[model samples]
Target: MKTESQLNIIFVPYLSPGHLNPMIDTARLFARHGVSVTIITTPANASTFQKAIDTDMNCGYNIRTQLVPFPTAQLGLPDGAENLKDGTSPEMLGKISYGMSMLKDPIELLFHDLQPDCLVTDLLYPWTVESAAKLGIPRLYYFSSSYFASCARHFIHEHKPHERLVSDTQKFSIPGLPHDIEMTTLQLEQWVRTKDEITDFMNAAYESESRSYGSLYNSFHELERDYEHLYKSTKGIKCWSVGPASSWANKSNEEKANRGHKEELAQEPQWLNWLNSKQNESVLYVNFGSLTRLSHAQIVEIAHGLENSGHSFIWVVRKKDENENGDRFLQEFEQRIKESNKGCIIWNWAPQLQILEHPATGGIVTHCGWNSILESVCAGLPMVTWPMFAEQFYNEKLLVDVLKIGVSVGAKENKFWASEGVDAVVGREKVSKAVVELMGKEESSEMRMRVRKLGDASKKSIDEGGTSYNNLMHLLDELKSLKASKALEKTNLKI
Candidate 1:
């Protein structure tokens, strides 16, 4: 191999936690392998993952953060409110999307100075493909989702089956996918249907992905063999499948050193202690994820539903949704649960990984975010899917219809916090039944076994000589080969 300096790669992430956190872990993985990595973010969003990045810094990794200001004032958003979580309506969320485009200049300037060997950016930043071209470096699209969802979207995009349907409710076969998947027009996320700015931006994003060097997925071949191959054949873009990357990077070495580290370990959340006392596979864990906001009525139904199911549970309730009706219902329920020791409620945040790994935790009632799906699968727990909005509905379909590892609460409406009011309320009866069936039935045991096999595969993929590990090694070797050729060409030009 021709002599060359170490390769440097820059990772640029979107503002949401779900998108940003996984990319951070991917960056850390690169650093661990002796690549210099820089993560691009707005100062406000940087704080979200900086602590984890700092941990690697302390551990002697070459990961660093580079900041580009999020255009808060230009978008008329309040100072420091740059992320999707801070937006209360679609209008403001739109502005946040607009702000991302304005970041192109600052990012391009940084690229000139760093002259990285490659650029890896989230799918939203369509401009990065050109940014990489300007510096004569390669760019790769980073999809912070499953290959199943991306493949589904690609088929829908090409076929336009939703366009010819009689009504939004009519179900049509997703054309050109390996699996026989059926989906209704309404289940498609809002962005796919419209002719608006967001739609235009995404169209451009897909175009950029098609033109880029390749795409990177946070998934592995063992988990989605057919879809991964289908994605490559359909898109014609080279891909690298190195994942369960989130858990692989974030898994605590300290805990691994003591695999038997009990729930009562020093500084463990008190919730874990409560979980440890419960019988094996006897508790239901519920959370709507970080960005979703439920109406007071919806919240009340879920509260009563969990109570009616008569199963032990721990629910993570958002502090933002509490009201007189919901607060009153939860308070009354909490007292009864305390007396009976049937449940626990955490008002804002819960330590998700620890709880999911606990032996007492049985099933999850989830928002079906891709990150959450991977985490749950890695824990070998089946889910009760309640998809709120965005691509989550598609994710739910993957779980309930394709994988058969989940039961649906049948999300009747796609409500985002960016909307004015609730679209539909899944009543207590439906919620209760789904929870009961998931936790108390033989089918649930079968699903748990199915998911546990996937979980084992997930763990193996990142281990030495596994599919994901080998893919990662091949990727690095190719990049090194490319670097050697570039260095030799420069030397010849000088001569």
Candidate 2:
């Protein structure tokens, strides 16, 4: 074996906050377990989590970041526009995808040069399956979402239940899942509803997953044990549930605050002070994640809704342009709320984990992103689930119907964030009602209790001798044995 000390694994994270952050956290967790870990990404993308990696290295963990050139200029994108959050328009997003595709060859070459024992890459990079095979290494597909979503998608794709529906609003049951999950055609992504180029890409990705050695999920065994069972039995792949990775990796407030992006906001203290001023579990936190741009009308409705709900809130607003349509109205609303001391509007990029862990934060208004859901669950907070696109609707079902910890805002359409318009906007009344129920109502007490228990389970899952911890140890042993077996085969051939 070529191993000097321990098994070496390379993590290839996709270039986005939701995907990038947790993958980096998982890499750090692996490093903490005495594995040699290297994260390979473009320079601009690496800059987002470089500080966190540096901290791990300083702590004497065997972790490092390897940089590659981001083909921004070649793809006609502006410098530093290497992440999905950097793409302001559909055209720019296309350029970013094309640029990412251009890196496949260079990344494969690195795979050959590094000669790691295993390749753990984002689900987006389906091509890596072949690269890992060429290098005679195991490839573990990194799924950043829940196992419930994965099983739901698999059944939906296999059964084609949505295809039999008459209207987009008609509900149908997904077949062969452990839980009875129902979803309307409107809730599914456009690619699932119809055949397109994206559909082909997704199909290729899943096929690659099935062909790979195994998969890694950022989920815990207790959170979705039934769905986890269903996923493995049907897909017939070896997998590990080692997650709540954020909590396990960033154990302290300082590490949580500096988890992603190095920029220090001048208004950080203001928000922290605002959060500190509130009572325990008294404030609502609203964020639509790194993607998901709301229209001007939607922003105005959200503003009115939060104001009318009679709750203290800290909303992370991602304004497209200073002169955009709702700029004047948002400015006026911010001033009024500021003077009233009722709400705080953070311009962009709030410290999410820090805010969630704060004692003052009670509930969340989330776009049903998996990362956001896990973070909230870990914080023991219920949610007002507003699913916009992707597998979010499935996640919403897990929260509202299965978990019973979320109140849905009754969002009806599933449009991509960039393509969202006023047509699918949940009115201010719906928003206000959901928030009131999630934050103030007596029924919310039960929801809080259930989530708190789950939060405790999430913490225990990562401790020594826990399910996730044991799974990690087993996976490492398997990788090391495989490496030794390969070395024996080579020796036999030489003899």
**TM-score of each model, in listed order:** 0.93, 0.97
* Distance from true location, Cα of 152 in model 2, Å: 0.6
**lDDT top scorer:** 2
Cα deviation of 485 in candidate 1 (Å)?
A: 1.0
Q: What global local distance difference test value does model 1 have?
A: 0.82
- Compared with the true structure, what per-residue lDDT tens digits does model 2 show for residues 80-196? 999998988889999998888888988888888888999999999999998898888999999999898898988888888998878999999989876678889989988988789
The segments of candidate 1 whose C-alpha lies over 4 angstroms from its true place after superposition are 1-4, 73-79, 253-268, 418-423
lDDT of each: 0.82, 0.89
Q: How do the residues 1-495 of candidate 1 rate in per-residue lDDT, one tens digit apiece? A: 111477788999888878886787788888888788898889888776666777788988888999998889877999878778777666888898778778888988999988899999999888889888888878989998878888888878888999998988888998887668887877787788766876887789778889898888888887788889888888888899888876788788343222211232346656767888899999999998888887777877888899899999999987767668777877887888878888998876666777788899998999989888988998889999999877888788788877889999977555565233455788899999999889985758889889999999999999989898888788877777887788889999999
Tell me the lDDT of model 2 at 141: 97
TM accuracy, model 2: 0.97
Query: Which ten residues in a row are the worst by lDDT in model 2?
Result: 416-425
- Candidate 1 displacement at residue 182 in angstroms: 1.6
